[model samples]
Target: MAYTAEAPAIAAGDDPMVPRIGRVRRRVRELSDVWTLTVEMEDGRPLAFAPGQFNMLTAFGVGEAAISISGDRDRADSGLIHTIRAVGPVSGALTRLGPGDVIGVRGPFGVGWPVDAAKGSDVVIVAGGLGLAPLRPLIYAVLASRKDYGRFALLFGARTPADILFRREIEQWRRRLDVEIQVTVDTSGEDWYGNVGVVTALVPQASFDPQNTIAYVCGPEVMMRFGAAALRDAGVPDTAMYLSMERNMKCGVGLCGHCQLGTAFVCRDGPVFRNDVLRPLMAVKEL
Candidate 1:
């Protein structure tokens, strides 16, 4: 189920094709089919990664999947975390793992969010459903250095209230006076009483200096496409907006062309890319 690409696909003096053994430290259920697993490498080294970067995780006998390191960047020195939804064969296997189980781990791969570039500027982050997983670390990094940036806003949406990931953590964040966090669901139950719309609907209402703003967005391809347009209509330029396009990433490295998007490789050039660089490629139908 794997193929070779190039011998130098992996740098940092490690083999690109080999995976290190990782033991699950803990597992928490986030939703009906979603779980967050905390893991530590058998070698005891941390899977320290930049915000928005991802890893290739193996469920041993099943398969491997590319997942973002969904942990607080400030605490990643302790271990790695990945919040995965049981949507596919590999992911289903990943979710079935529990504490004390061993799995295969590779990477901390690809470019990360431009946290440094946002210094002294307003930051608007938008996520839909599980997209929040990859952005969690960026939120932690930004707040840990709150004074380094200007206005901050987060807008999230899910299919239903029950499908909202990190519900409690997000509620805690909404309490912070300095950061603006809003959550909306597509459908509401009898007990639901919050906004019932897409996350992009909150973009135009967000408070930020469009001329000095940097935005990060992640979600379904359709969601991200509309989300980018919403940010642009709200006055943010394409250059200042970034998107995470994590699709068809077979190899964490570029050796496998499975993640190719136009001339760029989602596993190499991105998973994160500026709107200006991605819009054209994304516009091509069925690309």
Candidate 2:
């Protein structure tokens, strides 16, 4: 039977409709285009969230963007971390803010990765570009409870060596003997010394037992399709793999149909979905 995990509901004290005031605790320029912001709730409570869920960040006058929560879930006292690419007005504004600035936030909403279901299985994580941001928390969770799983592999692909999101952390993760890290870039300069190709190429080299592996993939739609195809060819069933999807989400609740993909709302039903549930919708380009 296919494994279709139900999306968990928002916890008590987390009202997606009510925007909370949060202060920017810190900001780090991750890349020329990407920035990581740490925010603390005005009330000093932690912004609790599961891995793969996102928050809608309001830039006061500019508007809002749905950004995935990228920090460690177990350390809520450290504040919520959002890694954002400044590609628009709102994101640009949010990125420009410094510490002590205030912003409107709603969420920690939507579905999350199936970490519990993946216990005892080999884990394969494939990420491309900024997609790594959303998947970072999952990696943290897996590493924190490393003994519960079998082999682990993380294959990341970026536009260039400079485009990699978490370079220092990737290096630290690489030092762990139990975790496998493979990095590749689409283009490279002389300083680069890594694989060069699409992320799917690294998929073939991952050391996971195909039948007993659970794969998590995030990236461009095209990249995800190819990654899913690669995982399928390697013997992973559709039900054992998942992907993250993004859409125009006006409201975090189900009332806004802006993020509807077929019957599923990217903001409500998922941002994370089992491959079997998303494959059909992905085929229709207009969705």
Q: Which candidate ranks first by lDDT, i.e. highest?
A: 2
lDDT of 1 by residue, 1-287 (tens): 11111112333777767898999999999999999999988988676678888889999999999999889876866788999999999999999999999999888778878778899999999999899999998999999999999999999999999999999998899889999988899999999999998889999888999999999999998999999999989889999998999778788778988887877778888888889988776666544
Expressed as tens digits, the lDDT of each residue in 189-284 for candidate 2 is 999878999999999899999999999999998999899999999889998999999898889777978998876778877889898888777666
> Could you tally the backbone clashes for each prediction?
0, 0
lDDT of 2: 0.89
Backbone clash pairs for candidate 1 read none
Against the true structure, candidate 1 has what lDDT?
Answer: 0.87
- What lDDT score goes with residue 149 in model 1? 97
Candidate 1 least-lDDT 10 residues: 1-10
Evaluate candidate 1 by giving its C-alpha RMSD to the native, one decimal: 4.3
Clashes of 1: 0
